[model samples]
Target: MTRADAPPRPENAAAWPRLAVVALGLLCLTEAAKLVAFHQAGPMPRASDAGAYWLLGAQVARGDVWMAERPVAYRTPGYPWFLGAVQAVCGHWAWCTAIAVQYAAVWVTTVLTGWWTWRVSARPWLAVLAVLVCVLSAARASHASLLLTETWFTLGLTVCGFLLSRPGALTQSRSTVAIAAAWCLTWLTRPIGAALLPAWLAIWWRDSGVGSGGTRWRAWPPLVLTGVVLAVGLGPWVVRNAVLFGRPSLTVFLGRELWVTTFGPGRPTAGGLPSTPEAEEIIRRASPDGEFTDWGGNWSVSNRLTASGLSDAEADALMARVARQGIAADPLRAGLRFVVRGIDYWRATYLRSLTDYDDLAGTASDVRDGQREWGNRACHRFRRAWLDAAPERNLLVVELSAALALMGLAGLWLAPSRRETALLVTALIAGIALSTAALEYPSYRYRMVLEPALIVCGVSGWPVLIDVIRRGSRTL
Candidate 1:
């Protein structure tokens, strides 16, 4: 008898994780090429907060944390400390090193985006798509090249999501401490990141069983412990502010932020009134030529105010009062602006803004041209837009954004595993955006922290989209 038909050999199909790693590598390389082209395209200034952060980093490198001879309360010590260390060692290559380190952070965030998508949605393909979206976003990927808090803040939020999104992650003692530290550092990096606190506490309260059969009241210990740890970590800075400013402070920049909404770029939104002679006098005194938008420029006004017989607290207080007066004078207009500002925060797409906003267009198109040569688009929408052409919107971005918004809404009910995570992520994003919207003018630069979480939620409702497509094909 012929024994020709033997049992078939077991297959050696590659694990999705290994495939994901390979995909991540390819994407990182692609992003690296785009960064190189961008770098090769003339110099990009360390404008706005970038310049201030650079200056603070320089001070840190010199082992002096003070700025303009006063204690550095305008900014927390996180990014400065981080940038200073890179600057101290890399020296001439500090820029490259800073970008490299931040790229690593972007890499981890991308991985987290995919990982959370896979775990929460239980869809590996969705996870891969999320990773692609995270990497392909021009603004999300480009911030790595700039010296800003976006990189570290995104990393911190992703890390916290990693720890907090799991079923019983908070149940572990180590995880609780780790999340506290991660979030604390993130808050230090950008104080706005502290907005996650309420969300975290809600998550903690939701699942603080302590053990398999413990009472809810007994869960209080761990929650209290976590809060105390974070508070203790922040104690020193608060004490410093208390001593220097006659009261404890988290940073004296809030009034300036509020002032900007009322008088700076947000003036039109506030009431569109021309500056008063009295306000102009102060503005000129602060900035001789009146450059109020720049981070350094605005801070100079405060410093000068402090030098001219007012304390740091007094300077900020004055700005706050000015901002308040503007809002009070036109409460209806100001309130409308506040709502629009918050809406704008989520509506902004960095891809279009990259090639249209301010001085960015000329430089961005040069990089876009470079990207064209290699068939590597930083943002695929910029196919033929020139460096000096009139500003135009990318219809593709507008269309996709609209479609995704619809899909995302449908995805809410489809994703059973995502309720807690979605709530947590949404609260963090909305909290940060709305708080800033109420106090300051809108800018997409600050939206970098919202990217990873957006991807996670955005990829959620694909099942419904897939079902619709399948039904249509069957009908056809």
Candidate 2:
């Protein structure tokens, strides 16, 4: 539909109240689920990454932000710092308080997702539907209850999307800076934010009309300004890493991650790595039973290497060298795997069975088991079934994701030639998928940060599909 054919845009006064009500309703439903799930899982905080996060927070609380004994470069300090503040204020109830904070972030993300949809599609109802999709996402809701980076990254991503989608955002200095700041924060939360830079640049270039007639030089300044903003935001962290490790690096674990994903056990053998007997021997000696896994898994070769003799920086460099060798041995296979990983990334999901809760009262396990037995009562079967199902393969997740993917694709195809909004969203998805695949094996949870953009794209396409179906039915 043309601009004139679209529904009237709601003014700020009318929109805020309605949006607020919708957001509150979502928060209520999500909180209810969280209470049930938390009760079911037990009060003890699950230790996957949460343990590391909590430890980092504890360090922060003690005024040791540098984590001198353990380099802070292993993980970014943003989420831990936030958790530290919660720990400081809430004391014994810190985990609970942190969960509450995460839920609030989810609510903010929901609101921004709705607002962005409305702005892009000019359809209020669809925008609301998009908000519902985001709030109801089992994967997203589950993450909010855990101490993880997903919630913060999701909020930052949605806010950034909303800002970039706004008309004249690129030309306006304040909006440009805001966008840059949001993107930088997202990077700090998770390295994936770096991949999103191109999408933002694409939008800015398209909106600014840089090549149409104006001096191409105009494009250079905004890009430079964005770079400077990011550099300034990251300056402290970079400086600390350089001074502490004597090398400039974003994170200490990237090389280790690359090595493990490429050449370690369980690494896809479809693309074989060249036989490097020396490096292979080193890895085998480091790993337990010659197997490699993530930091959380047993026989973590990376951790063993550090414990055995290598400094964090040296171990990282060793892994990087091994990873590069593996990739060099089979670039064709690596390239193919990257593509396959991109496809697998979307199909990934979080399993509820694995969620760990750190229980403060030491009653978490008993309480969880009691709740499970209590839920077995006939009255609770419906809720019990809902909670027990695998979150990644849950019918709701599978169907909704599939619908969004198909419809979002249709929407992009049906969208106007001059309209670059859909294309920009597509670019963001592509950037995320490609960047993620390049760094590590694909997992469902890795894609959580991109959920907001996915929902927006999926919702935008629904109207187009309905229009096509109606037209076909009338003709028939």
Candidate 3:
């Protein structure tokens, strides 16, 4: 194909210096903003899962990987182990250091996001816009202060996208290994990483040259190697869970999350633990008051069962059984719930956390009321303006969501005729979003990892959109 008919190419080498300068400037600005946000958020005390991670890190520092009295399979080991390693070197856990590292990871994610967009869309300016979207996203930046997997997972996803978007990445041995390693780390950080496997297989099947003149057997090595890496990366934790519970489970929390989303009041609506009638009966029978507090649902259920003479394994098994039964009993309802959950996941905004100014509060719950009030006001504003009617969601989040969704659609419309790139991107986003929705209520935080891909897609179509607008103006 001639240059004019071929897909748009990335900027020439002469533009590299300018791109580098722009990337560096954005990095510096983001880092500065992170520091300011961190200070404003003020020494955030480890709360909820953050506290659990801290305690687990302390235990790991003392040479015990399973810190809890019982085998803890609820959370994956990646983030806690990361914190443990940092604390081991620093002599104690330091939020400052951890947040700083996450900030740096954010910067890396931003750069890789830009690079991936440029490779796929061949638009240098759009790539810069992708970078800006990532860097300026208040939701993305706020994770720097929270000891969560968002930062690490975002960086992992971005790096994977960048690597796989390279020409011949699926067929090359080195790129295959790099992609495999990145994926393994990603799975360790969050179970959602498994969703990317189908995308990988799709890319490999299309690009690996197996069907043309090559033997099909040649494709097995990379696929096998990736599987082996994943197994090895997650082996030890799986083994521990197997030994402790007599069955290997990726995460015990899956059952709990399913129960909550399928049967409970769902996200942002707190109620008694195990919101299903059957699960509630189980917990109530175990408790003296015939009720369980909503605080720490996972622990509440587990502890109540264990207190009533059930082993940790038994409690988990029971919870899993309860969740499965709930789904099986009403398959149609479950399917409908999944649709609603998917909508909830995408429409969610990080405004509550962004506007939160309760960093100095003694307890995490101390500023919840204020955050809720702010969120309500945001919802009201959106309802009165852009949205004829709006749900109880943040206005900024609603606007951002609408903008990203529109741009992303435009990007897909303007994408090259080659189906491979579009397929891969769609699969990744759909896989993560749908899988999460199927099992749990989608939180904005959980969906944040996909932001890089969204930004790329949103910016990819910007040039096409502008051209159309210009043409229309001239015609007028």
Candidate 4:
């Protein structure tokens, strides 16, 4: 829909064609790779996390409604339930069609990302270059074909970033409403969207001045509406958790993860106690804490839970005791570890070839038939050989990375305004940091979500870099 008071179109509208052609070419290449993989794998319903997501879809397809269940409730219902709805219409055929639908969605997101770059920079060539870099990136292409939640989660986030990237979008009431709806939808799509909370609050605080009467009162309606919409989408899950699990929890899996990650076997406990296997052996030999804080926390939590496990109060007491012990001994050290772990998570390798990410394919492939399972030295050799098999295809990644990094630096230097530069810088830093913190799976997949934005900055920065080089040569 056209905005009634939208600014006049610039004379450079004709130049968008070249941008589209370039973007299209990149998309064609990306999609071609995905198509080949899909054809070979028959849609990857057997991938690691695919079982849970596919089952959710199956349940939805069969009209079996689920409420909050541990592990399951941790996932926001947008994607699996979405696939389930698709299955309802398409029946068993939807299983095969799911990956195709994801590809289509990703393609649309790529196009929109390009358009957003063009809108912000008003540079058609830069926009196309950004799209090209995103498509060609190895990290991005790896995850694009998977039957994972990252695809949809990334899409919703990208759209939200695109919308909020411009102040003008928020100035128009209708546009603001639309963007807010998308923002809420994004939160509904993934728990990571919680990070956007600070950004939203910042926007509301800043824009309170623009509302009617300059009293900030008019802003309340939209703010409240946004909250309500998000609640309507997410409240049912919380309610179900409360009723079914006897826990008024925001997420289903955090407590168990906390117990496991913080104090399990081979872990450093809250009291600065080193939990070697001996501790586990001791725990097994002794009465132990029965609390969920030590020894095989992951397996125990999932396996030991009955129709009704420990109550919320019991869980809290267990956590508190462990945390107190942990804090008393090495508070500073523990804090540092947590911080480092968070950084490690944020910077974890998420971008890599699909073969690299898949345990089943790597182990089962003919290339790995002779590989030693104990040391995996043979598997490594096979992987290297297989990866090198497509020597020419590797050039795409090298060029893409170099181009994007260069363009990103250039964009920061050449950004037309401080605000624009800050947006790019903040997003690049935050996206990478957040993604790294949330996942330990080191494949370029984590980077894919930020590819378009990174590309835009990189492309935007190019001219500035060239100018500097030319100026330096002249000085010499």
Q: Candidate 3: where is the Cα deviation over 4 Å?
A: 1-41, 66-70, 210-214, 266-284, 287-299, 351-357, 361-393, 396-403, 406-410, 465-476
* Per-prediction tally of clashes: 0, 12, 0, 22
Per-residue lDDT tens digits for candidate 4, residues 91-177, read: 645644665677666776777777777766677776776676555443453444455777776777677767766664444567667
lDDT of 4: 0.54
What stretches of model 1 exceed 4 Å from their correct place? 1-43, 65-70, 209-214, 266-269, 272-307, 349-410, 464-476
How do the predictions measure up, each by TM-score?
0.76, 0.81, 0.80, 0.70
Candidate 3 lDDT for residue 39: 37
Q: Order of candidates by lDDT, top first?
A: 2, 3, 1, 4
- What is the per-residue lDDT of model 2 for residues 24-45, given as tens digits with 9 covering 90 to 100? 5665476456445543442334
Which 10 residues in a row give candidate 1 its minimum summed lDDT? 366-375
**lDDT of residue 136 for candidate 1:** 56
Error of 2 at 454 (Å): 1.2
Between candidates 2 and 4, the lDDT winner: 2
Cα deviation at 159, candidate 1, in Å, is 1.9
True-structure RMSD for candidate 1:
7.7
Candidate number achieving the greatest TM-score relative to the actual structure: 2
